[model samples]
Target: MRNKLVEFKHVSFRYGDDQPWVLKDCSFCIYENEWVAIIGHNGSGKSTIAKLMNGLLFPQEGEIYINGQLVNDTSIWNIRKDVGMVFQNPDNQFVGTTVQDDVAFGMENRGFAREDMLKRIEQCLHAVGMEAYRLTEPHRLSGGQKQRVAIASVLAISPKILILDEATSMLDPKGRQEILSTVADVQQQHALSLITITHDLNEVTQSERVIVMNEGEVWNEATPRDIFKEKTALRKIGLDVPFVALLTDELREQHIQIDNEPLN
Candidate 1:
């Protein structure tokens, strides 16, 4: 059996006492080395779940576990060591003047040795195809390059779980594709669990599982192929299936069978 890397049990939360519940009775599991996407339209509580995972925002009514340890005030700091997050706005995430410095910032805080940080930085930058731009200033890079540097910074920390909270939302189509492909390659080289929160159904195609959130609750949880087949169900929750799903159906109608998986 696979080990559970992150688990949410009856989790609920709100920003203020008068605010509406952002997540109510939501529970799910993301397994080790699994790439899971948490998708929903805006205000559907998807991004809220991301903040809760790293203890940036604690649940008001339920328990969150990371590697079996309960998430609380005392455990939050330690939990962060194993959970790294990359937010949507790369501009807000950058601190260092140059690309290499930005990637090394996290390691420096964690007290990684200069020699070791240097080696890891090179490997991570290369992993994200950013090695050639290491000496360039972060502000000068394009949107996709900025996100790649952000990812490399997270990779330096070597967290067990990585959360990309709408990390591609601000990018253009090409930039978005670049970030997604980079993530897929990086994920293949590591054993970490990935939780990507986004509204884009296309982003979830590469995920092992999909957790559909609606109205502050878990609407559904299933493999991408299974979830894609349930077109009506997804539409009811305000999500539209991607073009691939439509193509799949067309091929099916013509009696064509894809011997492999529904998506790559």
Candidate 2:
């Protein structure tokens, strides 16, 4: 069995005492090198969970652990060293004047040896297929290209876990595909665990496991195929089913027999 990389035990949180709780006794585990997707409607507290995992925000109740260490003020930086996050907007992550420099920004902050930083820049850029854009300014790149650079920058950190918190929500279909393909290839090459937080149900079909959140609590956890099979249940929680699941339901209604379950 794979080691547990992240654990949330009875966690709960909110912005303040006056605000309502955002997460209510949420609990889950993400295993090493696994791809897990957290899906929920807006205000379901999915993004809040991501912030808590990396210590951007601490839970008002319960606990969060990363790589076997509890998340607190003192351990947050260390936790971040093992976890990389790419948020919804790729533009928000760009800091360098050029592509290569952008990839080096994190390493610079971490005090990577200059020689090692240069080498990692080349390797990460190539891994994300952004090598040819090495000299391009951040603003000049397309949305997809910018996200590729962001991924390259994160890869330079060599984190054990990567969190895509609505990473593709701002992109067009083509841009979304670009990021999805890039993430899959790099995850294999780097042996990194992936946590994708998204409301786009279609983007999550490839994950090894799916965690569905509703009203600030974990509603269900299952394999992607198993989760998609409950199209009616998923919709009742305000989540739409993927194309394949809907198609399967239609086929069955038409009396067309399918030999096996279909999940796209």
On lDDT, the leading prediction is: 2
User: By summed lDDT, which 10 consecutive residues of candidate 2 come out lowest?
Assistant: 255-264
Q: After the best TM-score superposition of candidate 1, give how far the Cα of residue 128 lies from its true spot, in angstroms.
A: 0.4
True lDDT of residue 164, candidate 1: 97
Model 1 reaches what TM-score against the true structure? 0.96
Give the residue spans of candidate 1 off by over 4 A: 257-264
Residue-level lDDT of model 2, residues 51-126, one tens digit each, is 9989999999999999999999999999999999999898889889999889999999999999999899999999
Question: Which lDDT tens digits does candidate 1 get at residues 1-264?
Answer: 889989999999999999999899998998988899999888999888988888889999989999877899999888999998999999999999999999999999999999999999999999999999989999999988999999999999999898999999999988988898788888879887888899989889888899999999998898888888889888887889999878987898899977865573
Clashing pairs in 1: none
lDDT of 2 at 195: 92
Q: lDDT values of the candidates?
A: 0.90, 0.91
Q: What's the C-alpha lDDT at position 172 in model 2?
A: 94
